[model samples]
Target: MDNQYYCNRCDREFQNFNAIKSHYSDSHKKTLHYACSTCYQCFETEAALATHRRNNPGAAPHQREPKAT
Candidate 1:
């Protein structure tokens, strides 16, 4: 069986865990900018933002992709 590693911080796909960890540590060791407009809350992934929006009736979270710097 093969495992696939997906990085939400950098929006990257990796085949190995070690490589993804190194890439994440080097490239995305910063704040994620996927903020919620209603409460100005930040989240690490879009799925988290979506879950937040779903939980909050009036959230209306922004659908922006955060670029790693």
Candidate 2:
């Protein structure tokens, strides 16, 4: 059996050892690309946009609230 590690941050699974290593170097290890210029906020992906929104509540418009009757 082959042994491999998983990355929860990127939500990716790897098979080859080299692939896993490179994925970490390119995605998980670095925060160079995942940055927001407007607020100087760092994020891993677009999904992280929501997290930034939470942190800087006054910086941007509030997230759409759930509708109520």
Candidate 3:
């Protein structure tokens, strides 16, 4: 359908950007907002960024881990 949006990465179709973005973030582990300040890189989630920081300590300021409430 012309109104449907197609995801090239996953070959999935969505009704809108929000749906596609959500699908991409979950299925592809891609970031919609969170980013690395030093390299201007983005991650799918905070945990992914944390992993990156652990692997690359010299890259940028580390993002604080979420505190358990």
Per-residue lDDT of candidate 3, residues 5-56 (tens digit): 4554666777654565677678887634444444433445677667767878
Better of 1 and 2 by lDDT: 1
Best-performing candidate as measured by lDDT: 1
**Model 2 C-alpha lDDT versus the unseen true structure:** 0.47
Alpha-carbon deviation at 29 in model 2, angstroms? 2.7
User: Per-residue lDDT for 1-69 in model 2, tens only?
Assistant: 243334446656555434544675677664322333334333445567667676676765533322212
Q: What's the count of clashing pairs in each model shown?
A: 0, 0, 1
Q: Record all residue pairs in model 3 with backbone atoms less than 3 Å apart, i.e. clashing.
A: 30-44
lDDT of each: 0.59, 0.47, 0.56
Which digits, one per residue and each the tens of the lDDT, describe model 1 over residues 1-69?
244556655567666545565566678774453555555445566778788788898755365644445
* Candidate 3: stretches off by over 4 Å: 1-31, 62-69
How many clashing pairs in candidate 1? 0
- Candidate 3 matches the true fold with a TM-score of 0.43
- lDDT rank, highest first? 1, 3, 2
Candidate number with the higher lDDT (2 or 3): 3
Model 2 TM-score is 0.32
TM-score between model 1 and native: 0.45
